[model samples]
Target: MPVLAGAEPFSHTASTEVGVLLCHGFTGSPASMRPWGRYLADLGHTVRCPRLPGHGTTWQECNRTRWTNWYDCVHTEFETLARSCESVFVFGLSMGGTLSLRLAQQLGDAVAGLALVNPSVLTLRKDARLLPVLGRVLPSVKGVGGDIAKPGVIEPAYARTPVRAAASLSRLWKLVREDLYKVTQPMLLMHSVVDHVVEPVNSRVIAEGVRSTQLTEVLLYDSYHVATLDNDAPLIFERSAEFVRSVRQVAA
Candidate 1:
């Protein structure tokens, strides 16, 4: 019998010279980041968006992996991008943004900047505690986004959430919040005021917590949770490109 290579091993991205490492949301694949990745790629950025462990596969596979595996996968991709490109930027969505935050904490001085779309950190509503403990158990959410109309990116392939895997995500956020002060890299945060999945407060909290002197925020006026493929996706790409350029100028 042969051993399976796992999720990250299955994720193969085309190599590029100057690129971005894009992390997708929880229970999401590279598809979630494809729009932004392609947008950057069109602007001459090499883009790398790899699927995390137990992702882009069956939900059972996802349930078997933890947050550590997911983090390691993204970190590996980041290293690959850095080695291949003259300069590298990091971008992420939802849970992916959480991973980006952790990366910034570790490599603030090295990271050119960050692009976070609809970032998810603390998502439970303020009144969520009213529900009973059992009633509050995280539900297994499947693919819920509407149509995705982008220039180059396609719809994500996987969506079923692994309840256990989601716990790992929460655990990772717990660790990342404590180190928020360590991230000083320039950041561009984009989110919708009407996002149904991740509350806007998540992005607000991150913007307030990061110690970076260079930080910018964009509110998606006509989108929901997945702003990358929503009405404002083009703006996402444009703003991200602009932010990266500004960061480069600052460094220069």
Candidate 2:
């Protein structure tokens, strides 16, 4: 499948021993994370942003993939970074955040730290409970993309929500929530105070559930769900870089 413009995965090889893996949200392509990756790379940190399977293409194709496919893609990228760097920090937005948390849980100290933006584990939508059944009859619904508060900034995401893929994501959410206690690494969590796609309670759930002793939470007042590309993006980038440096220094 031909990937969309600006949606291609990106990687930067730096001389530094520290690396950062960036994961974009469900249905969102690497375009959403490209700037952040560039910022880290400019700071001489090895960086990667992989395009999850079923993304960066048609939503119909996305419907054919499962959450495991996305997770596996991220896992491969992390392994690639781990092979070349002494320490690897995982950063994610939305569902990418969920996958990052799972990595920290399953990989343990292999993940030096985590920086999450609007990571989602739960949703309050009453209809979400019926996704398992609805997916059988429905192929898709309205998209949840382009929720950025910054005017004129657009996220390269699917125009429709793939029901089957979304159903698979819900299952992944349950698993991540169950294993939150295993995520013991230091974490930097940032969320939009006025996000329309993911509720603030989602971040609260993670903050309360994670076993990390060092947890920093910042609320984005100017951005929406996709804060990485919104008005508060620079703040997210700066804070994440600082967080990675602090964690890597401690690890050293």
Candidate 3:
């Protein structure tokens, strides 16, 4: 399948012995993560952002894939980074954060640290409970993309949310929540104070559930769900870089 323009995966190799793997959100392409990857790369960190399976193409095609496929893609990328770098950190936005958490849980200390932006583990929407039933009858619904507060900045995401894929995502959320205690690595979590797509409670759940003693939480007042591309983007980039450096120092 031909990927949409600006949705191709991004990779940068650097002399730094640190590797950072970025994961984009559900229905969002690598375009949403490219700038962040570039920022890290410019700072001498090796970076990669993989296009999740069933993403970067039409939403209709996304419906044909399951959450496991997306997780597998992220796992592969992390392994590649681990092979070449002395320390590998995982960074993710939205559902990508969920995948990153799962990776940390399964791989344990293999992941140096985690930096998550508006990661979703639960949704307060009452209609979300009907996804299992609705997925059987409906192909898709309205998209949840482009919730950026910054005007004229668009996220390269699907115009519609695929029903089946979303249903599978719900299952993934349940599993991740159950294993939250297994995530003991250091973490930095950033969330928008005014996000319209994911509720703030999702981040709260993660903060309360994780066993990480080195957790840092930052609230973003200027951006929405896609804060990585919004007004507080610089904050996200700088703070994450600092977090990584701090972790490296601790390891040393």
TM-score of 3: 0.99
Candidate with maximal lDDT: 3
C-alpha displacement of 38 in model 3, angstroms? 0.5
lDDT of 3 by residue, 171-194 (tens): 999999999999999999999999
In the range 145-209, model 1's lDDT, one tens digit per residue, is 33343345344544655666766677787788888889888889888878777877888789888
Scored against the true structure, residue 4 in model 3 reaches a CA lDDT of 97
Model 2 TM-score, 2 decimals: 0.99
Candidate 1: residue 7 lDDT (0-100):
25
- lDDT leaderboard ranking: 3, 2, 1
What does the lDDT read for residue 156 in candidate 2?
88
The weakest ten consecutive residues by lDDT in model 1 span 1-10
Give the TM-scores of the predictions, in the order they appear.
0.83, 0.99, 0.99
Comparing 2 and 3 by lDDT, which wins?
A: 3
lDDT, candidate 2, 1-252, per-residue tens: 999999999999995589999999989999999999999999999999999999999999999999999999999999999999989999999999999999998999999999999999999999999999999999999999989998899998999999999999999999999999999999999999998899899999999999999999998999999999999999999999899878877777
